[model samples]
Target: MPVRTAVPADLDALVALELRAFTGDRLSRAQYRRHLVSPHAAVLVADAADEGLLGSALVFFRKGSTLARLYSIATAPAARGRGIGADLLAAAEQAARRRGSRALRLEVRVDNAAAIGLYERAGYRRIGLYAGYYQDGADAWRYEKPLAVP
Candidate 1:
């Protein structure tokens, strides 16, 4: 398995993985494309030598000083349970820290226990909650991890 910075060439694979991982969610391909082209955004891909994209993580920088917000993270169905998600997350954190980010943050649906577990194990702490944050009216739990000691 190899972890690398996602390039425009990986757009198609990233989009496909987004659709699969977001099954019930509704973000269009155009939106995904726009994100890929955003100046403050980045996507990391985990590829298997013989296969292809195994996992992907999209991180966005909101207006402010050095803070990265992980928008969406997905691992190909066949690639789950193998630490691919963890690897992608570690890559994202490393990139953010290199970019001088002060912290990393993300919001996950309250019902997404699996992801919540992953985040917790990754050193993210639940900071707060947002009611009805998802289109489906699901509550979201905000998680954060400091990139540097304050």
Candidate 2:
């Protein structure tokens, strides 16, 4: 699957993908619109012409910080187990590095074993946790991976 930086044309499809992959705390259409043009964000999508939109990732970077945060990542139900998530994650990391980020970070709900396992296998180490990080009072495990050797 080909993953590319998302453009305005992908807004609706991206929003739909987010809804399909997540239950709550999903990104809004407006948020997706803004992030598409935001200088601080890298919005990437897996676009397979025949399949339409497959997945998306919203990774953020601070102006003066070397740390890049993966705000969100989601793959459509039909695309799961096909490694689309890993492809999006790799693309996001490359984008962050191009933007001068040395490390990437993300927070996943503690109960999401699949996601947690994916992160671990990708070389991301759990470094901390946020109590009640989700709107539903679910805790989150924070993980980080260095894009460049420190």
Candidate 3:
């Protein structure tokens, strides 16, 4: 899989994929559009050979900070279990490192075992918990990992 910064052409597919990937608290189409051009955010898309988009990862690089947030990551249903998530994650970490981020952070639903496992396998460690973080009143586990400076 080839991971690259998302362009405006990827908007519709990204929006549609996220709608199916998350049951609630999904990013809006407008947000995706902004991310494509936002200086503080990096939106990456994973594409397969002749298959278009397989997943999208959004990371935020806070100004004047060494921390980058792995704001959102969504893989298409047909592309799950194919290592797309891991690839996207590694790509995010590398992108963050290039931008001077020393660490990457994210929040995941406490009940999402698979996602937690993926993050952990990628070296993210749980650092905190946010109560009722999601719109549907679900708690979130905060995780962070040190990024190797590029």
Candidate 4:
């Protein structure tokens, strides 16, 4: 598996992966295409040796600050449990650090225990909660991890 910066051509596959990971509230092909062209966004793709675009991470830069916000991360259903998510996250963090970000932050659905676990394992700490953060009225757990040295 390889982790690399996403290109506009990868939008279709990313949309497919997003649909696979989240059965509800999926991003359309148009949204992904726009994401690829966004100036403040850094998207990474995880590609397999045989298959392509196994996973993706979309990181958006916070305005007027050195912080990178993880907007979304999803791995293909068939690619789950294979560390692809981990790889994509690592890439995102590294890219954020390279761009002078002091920390990485994101909100995970409170009901998504598995994703919370993954974020915890990746060194994020739950800093707060947001009520009704999701489209379906689900709450969110905000997590943050420092990217710079003490």
Give the lowest summed-lDDT range of ten residues in model 3. Answer: 47-56
lDDT assessment of candidate 3: 0.93
| TM-score of structure candidate 3 | 0.97
Q: What is the lDDT of residue 64 in candidate 2?
A: 92
- For model 2, residues 1-150, the per-residue Cα lDDT tens digits are 799999999998998898899999999999999999999999999999999999999999998999999999899999899999899998989998898899999999999998998899999999999999999999999999999732
Which structure is stronger by TM-score: 1 or 4? 4
Q: Report lDDT (Cα) of residue 120, candidate 1.
A: 99
Name the runs in model 2 displaced over 4 angstroms.
none
Give the poorly placed runs of model 3, Cα more than 4 Å off: none
Model 2 whole-model lDDT (C-alpha atoms): 0.93
Query: What TM-score would you give candidate 4 relative to the actual structure?
Result: 0.93
Tens digit per residue, CA lDDT, model 4, 2-79:
899989888778887887889766778887887788878888999876898899998988668898899888888887
**lDDT of each structure?**
0.84, 0.93, 0.93, 0.88
Model 1 lDDT on a 0 to 1 scale: 0.84
* Model 3: residue 117 alpha-carbon error in angstroms: 0.3
lDDT, residue 144, model 2: 98
Residue-by-residue lDDT tens digits, candidate 3, 13-94: 8898898788888999999999999999999999876887889999998789999999999998888999999999999999
Q: Which ten residues in a row have the lowest lDDT in candidate 1?
A: 23-32
Relative to the unseen true structure, what is the C-alpha lDDT of residue 80 in candidate 1, on a scale of 0 to 100?
Answer: 83
Q: Which residue pairs clash in candidate 3? A: none
* Pairs clashing within candidate 2: none
What's every prediction's RMSD, in angstroms?
A: 2.0, 1.4, 0.9, 1.6
- Winner by lDDT between candidate 2 and candidate 1: 2
